[model samples]
Target: MKYDVAVLGAGMVGVCVAIHLLQQGRSVLLMDRNDAGEETSYGNAGLLQQEAVRPYEFPHEPSVLLPAAFNLRLDVRYHLTALPKLIQPLWSYFRHCSPRRYESIAQEYGHIINMTLACHQELISAAGAEQLIRKVGWISLYRTAKGRHKGLRTLDAYTRQGVNFKVLNGDELAEIEPAIKGHHAGGVHWQDPWIAGHPGQLVKAYTNLFKQLGGVFVQGDAGSLKRSHQQSWQLRDHQDTLLEVDEIVIALGPWSAEITARFGYRPPMFFKRGYHMHYQYPAGQPRLTRAVQDSEKGYMMTPMDAGLRICTGAELGLRDTPSTPVQIDRAEAIARKLIPLGERLDAEPWRGARPCIPDMKPIIGPLPGAPGLWCAFGHGHQGFTMGPATGKLLAAMMTGQTTDIDMSGFRAERFKKP
Candidate 1:
């Protein structure tokens, strides 16, 4: 039987597409290669900032990649065998980091960030997962004057973009988080309507809700797409199983590059691996109510139902070895810098790859070749934060409804070579 829409990749975004499509009275089928949300979506900082103004490609991010080559912990690294495959993405990264290009991308991202938190909350209510979410604002701490200066610049961008924030001094920070120890130069207290639950739990809840709302969950890996004479899509599964649908949505995250190629569109993208360390504190230890980012170290500590999590930005080349003890050790060192008792916490680190594009904005529009196919991936670090928002927008496009926000910037064809 042909379905209305078949969404590939059952991660946060994929499942969200399922739920949104179902809500619109469409016959949706969601599929994934593995258990839902176990990959990148399940483990992340889980921040949702409605007022986020700064884009991922800050002015220094592109140039930092080159200098980061020497310091594996700071930038992308590759195994000797993987060097050939890593060159193109590495160069493209630096190219996008220029101020002229980064500013343009940031402008587009600013609009997206404006709606992220609200969309997450709508999903939270739709899934009845409010107990799993927390509206606590985010705090970014700076241990150095340079980091503080960077925060000021970020604040300037936020101000220009009209994002809300409360600049806090060290003493004010102490009053809010007394357990936090360290002489912070200063901090930016920004309110982000973020979730503090198991992201995996939220994904499962969405999937379950979709199924109950009359959606089908297909368990297969989509191999390629064959266009039918009627202009529909026939998806070839791993075991040669056939599934045909009226429309197809490619919400596949990291693997989107592989899938889109069959449709004659080669996205300019790569994988940037990030790490998260989770550990339970002593029963009496103070628990943080909000998330904190140590700006200088490029890491964040988030409070979740599971435990306090310390996640770091360790971008490795696609061929780099899986995270090593030393890589996690670097995260531990940064954790100690932010949390004085990090040594006592004894957190164990978990690592995963985040799908990234050069411009650092999510690709969330139509597929290039197949008329009925759509693309919704490349969210990178903000996949969890942007998943629901992207899904709602994609659903609008698929059904020919108007989107609340301007979506011309997120077109998948934007990165296509002329």
Candidate 2:
């Protein structure tokens, strides 16, 4: 069946785009290789933080990466097995690691991060999933005064960027979370305007709403596209099922690299697979109202209906591989250190790989050199946090509506490396 738009992914970003397009009275066919929202969307920390702090890179990143690069627990390793030719991307990363570059990138990210929380509230309320959201706040803990000092710089940076945070001492930290161990010198209590509900459920609600609004979901793998004599391109599924669409959105997460590779536009994308373990709180266990990050441990503990979840940094280069014994062990080790409500925690581990762009910013605009093709991937760690706002902007741009925020930095053409 002919559709007005075919969204080539059912992840959070793709589903949100489909919903937004449907809201604009456009027909949409949302396709995915697996169950919708069951990938990165399902197994995330589930915090909708619109902290507006800064990008992952900063001016001090060189110093930070030097030490953290070797910390397996931190999940920031570089692969020596890659070919020598990979130096270009590595060199590019090194150049961008400078504080000057980070400052510029962070400023751009701060602009978009500020818009997500409001977008989240509007969308979640419209979807009727308010119970799944919590605005309690987020905590960042440090085991040593040195870590606290590092965190202080971050706090200062955030403050300069218009993000406010409350500083808490070790005693106050214990008072706030008695279950938490370690005599942290101090910590920071940051207000994240954008907090999250159950992201998986939210995606389901959006797609369901879209279908209810007459949007179609074609459940199959989207194959290559070809231009028609009439100028519009035709999209096909794995079974050779041809469908015509006026426009298409390529929001296929990590798979976008493979999909675009066929069209001679391979992105410098890789997977940073992360793992999270959910536990059922035992009776009398302390409840964490907000998400907490163990700075030294390199993981985060977030509250959910089942219980609190603990997740850690990316496991580099193991994108499509199944969760290994090592990955699960590392996640559990970090969880055991951070979460206070884990007495009856289950042993099961949940894992997902996210599409990571080297610069840590998403490619969010019209597809490079391809008319009627748009990109919305490489969000890395912020897909859940940024998906709604991105959808609104892209949808507005597609439908000739005015955008709420400026999006000059997220141009997909940034990586025009042939």
- The sequence of per-residue lDDT tens digits that candidate 2 reaches over residues 1-418 is 7888888998889988888888888888888877678888888888777774475552245566666456444544334444253456445655776877877888877777888888777777777777777777888888899889877876767778888678999998888877776677878887655345466877787677667778877667766567767767687676778888888898888788766666567777766677777777757767777778877666777777777777767665546554553644665666665555555355657767768776767888887777788888888888888887788888888898877767767877788776
Give the per-residue lDDT digits (tens) of candidate 1, residues 51-129.
5555565234545645565564432344545558767766777677687877777787877777777777777777788
The Cα error of candidate 1 at residue 117, in Å, is 1.8
Positional deviation of residue 88's Cα in model 2 after best superposition, in angstroms: 4.0
Where does candidate 1 have its weakest 10-residue lDDT segment?
339-348
lDDT of candidate 1 at residue 59, scale 0 to 100: 31
RMSD of 1: 2.9
Which predicted model would earn the best lDDT?
Answer: 1
Measured against the true structure, the TM-scores of the candidates, in listed sequence, are: 0.90, 0.90
In model 1, residue pairs whose N, Cα or C atoms come closer than 3 Å (at least 3 residues apart or on different chains), thus clashing, are none
Tell me the deviation in Å of residue 269 in model 2: 1.5
Model 1 scores a TM of 0.90
Q: What is the C-alpha local distance difference test score of candidate 1?
A: 0.75
